[model samples]
Target: MQGEDDLRGLAKIMGFMRAVSIILVIMHLYWFCYGFFAQRQWTLELINKILQNFNKTAGLFSHSLYSKLFAVLLLGLSCLGTKGVKNEKISWKKILIISSIGTVLFFFNSFLLKFPASGATSFYILSTGAGYILLMQAGVWISRLLTTNLMTDVFNNENESFQQETRLLYNEYSVNLPTKFYYHGNWHKGWINVVNPFRATIVLGTPGSGKSYAVVNNYIRQHIEKGFSMYIYDFKFDDLSTIAYNHLLKHSHSYRVKPKFYVINFDDPRRSHRCNPLNPEFMTDISDAYEAAYTIMLNLNRSWIQKQGDFFVESPIILLAAII
Candidate 1:
């Protein structure tokens, strides 16, 4: 039985190694293509043209596309490498850290030497080469890490068992608390009580519905003041800015308040201003909440599809009808 278990573990490791190898190969291919065929001069000109046409507004579409493409590529490589190792011990945290570091270094080097018009000088050439070497080493390290049984905590420890494992039967479709919420204390005169954490609810209404005020003023003031980190993805700078500014002044703690307002004017590149969130010159306003929500959903769905291949699989007619 012990021998069989060892064999299974080895097989899982081998599977992960194979997947990492494929991912590395793909990365190499991308680099080669960019270096040889997609000439930097042309690419820069193209980007300039795109910027000229779309200006700051291009971020709405372009950023999402770029993010999704990278995400899918990573997910595909992961799936290919660990198709049959679903039950195997995996250190996701370590994997994330290593992968993020590798990606950052890759871009850093590429931007520094490769993208700039002037090529690397004799003094910096060796350093640039060393950076590339480190990137390749990072990739190899990730591959080895994935294959090795380094994460003993995953299976060998009872105390470290996840909540799902503690339960007898595992069901993925369990109701859980929404990650975020908008609460209004001032509107109802403290009538709003703390709702059960497990329930997912959305308070929807028109402009005067107190949604923005609740989210920015009341909820942020109550929860965020108590050391909770919160993010408000406000597209059009409005009430969020007001609340943030007020919080900064009122709180004795040095609260850093920054508002980023983008002036996406196609006419003038110089006028295309983006304020720093920490030292924001403008207010926080979000125009299209629906578009923002849709973007979030789209990304979420893509991630879901990557994790569970059959997540969106349905009858042909049903799928087609839904798409229509």
Candidate 2:
């Protein structure tokens, strides 16, 4: 209630300021055009004397620079009472443009440095009058823009968030992802299509973000169902490996050549099938031995990858290749 009263009082004060400014502007215009409004009967001696006193004041003349300046200042002050809103956004650039042009026109007493002839003040009045009205409106708009509640005014309809594509595309080798999204107050079904599964697609996410359960497992199951031969490198021995083993077992009939499931446990030799790395059955050329030796040494010491031509490095590699 106190705040409301304060606002009401401020509005009343602003109204008084506006009234005083307009009255002064009119008085100034009338005094400057005293000859134009001649031949009028004097109603009272005191009223005539009072108006005559103003005629002597230099600033009351329309041609005086201070006359327009005083009016502009008061109008600007009165604009402080302009009301602001929460949901609407005002364009400051437009307000500035209007106010600047109005200021220039309001101060214009002549056109192109040429003053009108005697008794031809009507055109000057019309131009400045239009300019005064524009200034009045622009001033109020600027005040309202400055006082607006920016937080809520800017977010009335959350337009900054980008629009996501919701169209679902499909192809012969595409992996489809089913989803649901929100729009216009209700949830709707959506799909993300990976059109070419043969092209490498990396699944990336933070821990517990469903990298395995939602995406990896789905891809494994679908690929198995499509009769794809997979070589899975599982970090968690049982997590993905177990899923692939069980899925392939169920979908084994889908493959033209029934694929066997083999488990290689490097930590437990008893659980792993014994195999020789230097087995001659798999080597087609001498380069195959060198490749095996290169991979072994690099895995043992990764820095050796940059030291390929070093004698100590090449010697061991050559020895390993001969043994293989």
Candidate 3:
């Protein structure tokens, strides 16, 4: 029991670390987006400039080297943090020692490279700037790598926990249900095998056989603590509104509940009003709201078909029929 509790505690810590690492990675990725997509050549040029500036002996012996070295150390620290190392064990003493050595080397190199034609100060400044940039890159890389590792670890841990929880639940309810619940297939059937809290055991039943309640009570409620987001589509407003309200109330500020109901009747003015506000309305020059809704529906349908992985030469005909 103690072992299980310890595992659970470690799992929780790992989960939190994973979330933080992911957030940091996302922020770093956002910052690097321009370099990745738009200004890649400029970024490479800047890196090259830094390398050239550091090649000079005087440029090498500056505060810039210490800064670069410290930056690298910071990246290592981030990795250690992700790995669940305590803050006290981070070894600031070692980092300071290395930084001091780097600082001395930088100044010595600067003195050696102070020739008649060389602009030692300018070179030092450029090298230092380059080193700072490299440090940022190192931090980003460390965050990204740690995020990946943490996610993988947490996923594995959660999967095992889920299996254990499911078994316990099954034992409690096995007498009630005909089929015994067991782990099977990818929890989330996407490109990656993500363990979906919602997509658990599929109900083998016809309509109005309590399938909906079974899904809601058994799966959704069970994983409520895991910070799962869900959207339930129901034609009836009352059911959907109730579910949405309950979700909003239960989750409070931490979770979001968005209920989207398809209003097929475009002829009714109220129906038009009920449509997604951001939806395009090409029919009226004043507002493209209806058109936007239509586009969303079309995209949803297309996505469904794509998920099915069925392609045909006559797909255009089927799509036209759907539009009609």
lDDT of 3 by residue, 1-324 (tens): 455687577666655654554443333222323233233352455644554464454343244334334444544454443433212222435445544554444333445234433355345444443443444333444444444444344444432422223222232212122233223323421111224323455557887787756554434443333344555444554465466556556655454553332334444566433544443342454224434444555565675534443454235434544444
lDDT of 3: 0.42
Error of 3 at 296 (Å): 9.0
What are the RMSD figures for all models against the true structure?
30.1, 17.2, 20.5
Model with the higher lDDT, candidate 1 or 2: 2
Off by over 4 Å in 2: 1-172
Residue 97, candidate 3: how far off, in angstroms? 97
Ranking by TM-score: 2, 3, 1
Candidate 2, residues 53-136: lDDT per residue as tens digits? Answer: 765774355355566778888998998775644335457778888888887877865562243354456666666777788899
- Model 1, span 1-324: residue lDDT tens: 353467568667755654554454343333323443355433455654554454356442233224224433543444433322223433556556655665554444433433444343222334433433444444445554555454553443332222221122212322222222222111111233434423644668888886655543665565434434456544555456456546644652633543332344335567555534322233233323333333444555565434433544323323433332
The lDDT for every candidate, in the order shown, is: 0.42, 0.74, 0.42
Q: Could you tell me every candidate's TM-score relative to the true structure?
A: 0.22, 0.52, 0.24
In candidate 3, where is summed lDDT lowest over 10 consecutive residues? 172-181
Question: Who wins the TM-score comparison?
Answer: 2
* CA lDDT for candidate 1: 0.42
Off by over 4 Å in 3: 1-166, 169-201, 217-225, 256-324
